[model samples]
Target: MTVIGIAADFDPPHRGHAYLLDRARDLGDEVVVFLNADYTAHHTPPLLPYRLRREIVLELGADEVIPVRGYHQRFPLAYTVPVRVRLMAEEGVDVILDAGPSRNLDRLREHVERVLEVSDLFSIPPNVPARNVVRWLAAVEYVNRELGTDVELLLIPELEGYSGRKIRAALRRSGYSPDSLRKVRRHLPRETFKKLERYLKARTPPIARRKELLDVLNRASSYELCSIAHLNTIAVREILRGRPFRSERQVWGALRRADYGSVLTRLALANTECRVTSDEIARIALSWCVERLVPENQSPDSMYRRDWFVAALSSHGVKARDADRLYKRADSYEEARRLARRRYGVDPGVPRFETLIGEARVSDGEYRPAISANGRLGVVEDGFQELRATAFGATLLRYVLDDPFVDAVIRVEDEEARLIVFPGDSP
Candidate 1:
């Protein structure tokens, strides 16, 4: 049997995902799919829990699906490729297909028959228009180029662009509206969606939770209503957002997780005509609120940036603790780019670092030194010297007091305990 293997996060398999699996099947006599375990996707939270998601893929037409655990303490995605390759090798895979941009193709090719890149067809051909083809493709190219690989791009114009991310967002919406569910169906394969609907029905909270919220909504402010209804204050505030529930669609953003019951309970309460399903609420929310990543004009100091990032995320409904993790990631991204530029004149477009990246918590105007490759801490002192970037105690200094025009080089020495930079230059 000619076995083919492919790996994906597949938190919830959508139409585009179905296309890839179909292609994988065409490439070999048998197909095996590697499902990324939940809690492994670094930046995004899973829409469904681990076991539920695994069950979802099993229904989505994967021939042989196996969920794998993470091996690395950090940078699991990078490490995931090796684990997949090893497992697939044992399964006698003839070709390991990589359709996504994010994967270590170079390393995988060494062990497998060959790492074959599947052409992602569809300018978003069917189901729903792609979430954002330009942005998603740019991210893809950046990853491949950073790793110095030339993966073939295939064009299958008939295949549609089905985004699981959009589908998941659509699911987290206000009252379960039939219209919303109808819209979602357009983007999902009929069989897959039918199964999904059945699963969603099972997950809806009982109606008792709805009646409790309705009574509280009748007489109290959102804050007071939480205590009266035994609901979480933050979710209630988010659902209300300081305004009365004027329309179900208008408030779907806040209603996504506002109640345990179906979103329709809130909708029905807003106006008794609501007869929606949980699936509809999600679809409406996705059509209304699109996710965008806007770069922050970050502070030079890392700790201050954390505060700024937290405040920004809080306003958009992310909790305080989760916001902290996001801030750390942003800081690490910036720090890597800054360090890489100072050392190697060329930028790889994305970062893969060896040093443990962290943000300094306090600002004392002291030059934050990076531990060199050889394990020596960098320091700045007053003297004239020059050295290599990766050397221990070797430093890159900027913004110092000196004769502004004298063109002085900051002295860096491996053996020196103190780093000396007579100010005047800015990096």
Candidate 2:
């Protein structure tokens, strides 16, 4: 049995996605899709939920749909590509099908190899059309070398005149009404258009939590705001100075003043909405760090420390090559920070909280008025002290806030506290 693989967000299944699925079906007996989770690669919520997107893909002829989570929220494309390639390799995928700008596979592979030779974190050459095509090819070659996998890449010409941005803009402009759906009908498949119409009528679009995001940004202290991902020191200062934001636009203006581009600004807002801290991002990155990056004979403790250092540096915008250099020269995280500053003039973006000392479990609590407008404030007992806490994220705020019992790791700074709750188990 031949297994073909594809990785896509498929935010809302469109004509391009349908084309890819059809191509993969023709080339292989099984088509396996690795779909992005609720969040897209740009660290924003998709227009549709993950379940809906998966259902549409299956309806379009995917044999299996696997959720690719954790990495996309924090890491760059360079870090994520290798992880996806490894997932395909592990899933027994024989060939990966993708749409690229050019049909010249050898040329694309050559471009990827050159970029990989320089640094894995470096972006593909701008002159190269369809950089993601080169990225996937590079990742496959790297994974094959490191893990001895024999997966192959198959590139097909990308279908033009289908744009997710254009479709999304039309939907938003028309308030996601049936009329807007009809306006962008040609960009979508027949099934996609029908399903989307039903979805728009039955359920609200998967838009960002603007009210909750604004409340957090307006109320959070500079120190607390700085802890969120994509918010640098300058951004924090700008946000703090422009407190009491009445609308999302005001907050965006502050970020613009802070020199944040469109994507980074959106990411900062999304992170604030989820209350995603730098420490949490570092922890997530550590989980994704491939074992093959390190030697086999290294002790578990040493390997963990090295991975932690790399993850931390990556979160701080340090390139992979520089992070590796710092890992070899420094004996501890503090030493690594010093070395990075001395050599590369890198400033530690977020203040590192103390390591997880112990665990605490929270019991039932009633709703109380707090920082977030959604009334999610509560009290959590950590060791001998009780700390005031506010929970964010859709599922967390909905269920855990009022649940009878939950286990979490509490990290505190001064009187402010943030909870790190891992699903299914206590950290």
Candidate 3:
């Protein structure tokens, strides 16, 4: 039995999606779709929830629908694409069906080969259109070579006149009203329109996790923010510069002024919402490398020097080839830094202690109260006391106040009251 596989967001499964599924059915006996999770690859929540999107796709004619998890949402395509291609290979998919700008298969293959040869998908030239197409093609080739799989690429011309962005914008503008559905009726399949209308009337669409995102943006320390995936020192400073953002738009404006592109801005917001730390991404990458590359009996320690792990290390501004070289030569992280500095005459943008605080802390207690950054009731002092807290201390205090099980510890030292907070279960 031949199985055709496709990976997509299918945010609202329109006529374009249905057409692709029809083509898949024509070519193969079974069609499997790997749908993006609650968050899309672009780092935003779907207009509809994952459950609704999955149901829509299944209704549209998918034999099996698998959900890609949060790990894909945390990093750039350079890191996640290989993992996705590996998934398709492991599923026994014979043909990977996708739509690209060009219909020339030989040209696409050549482009993919060139990218893999350089080992740097991040440095694709700006003049090249459809970089994602190149990235996917490269991923399929890389995974096929590594896993010894025979997954063939099937490229179809991109269907025109159905823009998911325009449909979503209309829905939002009309508040998901029935009239809005009617306006975009031509773009959606009959089944998709009916399902979406019924779903929208019965329940409101799920919104982005803006409150959680703002909570992290307004409260998280610079050091804590730096630990999030896709966030560098400059990005963290941009977020900090726009203090106490009232909404996501304000944060977007700040990032835009700092020359952050749409993709990076969305990634920042998504990372903040999920609180995805760099450490977490590294662990996920290491596990993926071990699973796909390492021998079953071999130690996992050797997995760190592999390609995927090198890609993960490249997140901190190191080039992929350079990271691979440094990984083999340097015994420790500090040694790697030293080598990079010597070779490049500059640090590879690693997060350092000095970057944590761009400004000095002031000791004036009256100016900086003991309250949390969100202005919630953090501390109550019965007697006279002066309170001064560091950014890290305030962040911890905010977390402590938010946790229901933790109790705040208050101490009185000679006429000054100090707040000592720790996270623990209630006695």
Candidate 2 vs 3: which has more lDDT: 2
Q: Candidate 1's residue-wise lDDT over 1-427, tens digit each?
A: 6676666666566677677778766766877776666333422334445565566566665677777653211121222333344455556665666454334434323222211121111112233223222223332343344333332322233344667656655665634333355667877766656655665665642221234333444444322322121123334445444345544333444555555344233323322122222123222222222221111121112223333344334444556566554444333645533543454332323311122222223222333232222232232323111223332112112111101111112232233223332211222
Tell me each candidate's TM-score: 0.36, 0.68, 0.69
Which residue pairs show backbone clashes in model 2? none
The TM-score measured for candidate 3 stands at: 0.69
lDDT (tens digit, per residue) of candidate 2 on 320-378: 56787766655555677788777767644333222322222344331111122222233
Task: Point out where model 3 deviates above 4 Å.
Answer: 291-427
lDDT (Cα, 0-100) at 362 in candidate 2 = 44
lDDT of 3 by residue, 174-219 (tens): 8777668988999998878888888887777755336778888898
- Return the lDDT, model 1, position 413: 29
Per-model C-alpha RMSD: 18.9, 10.0, 9.9
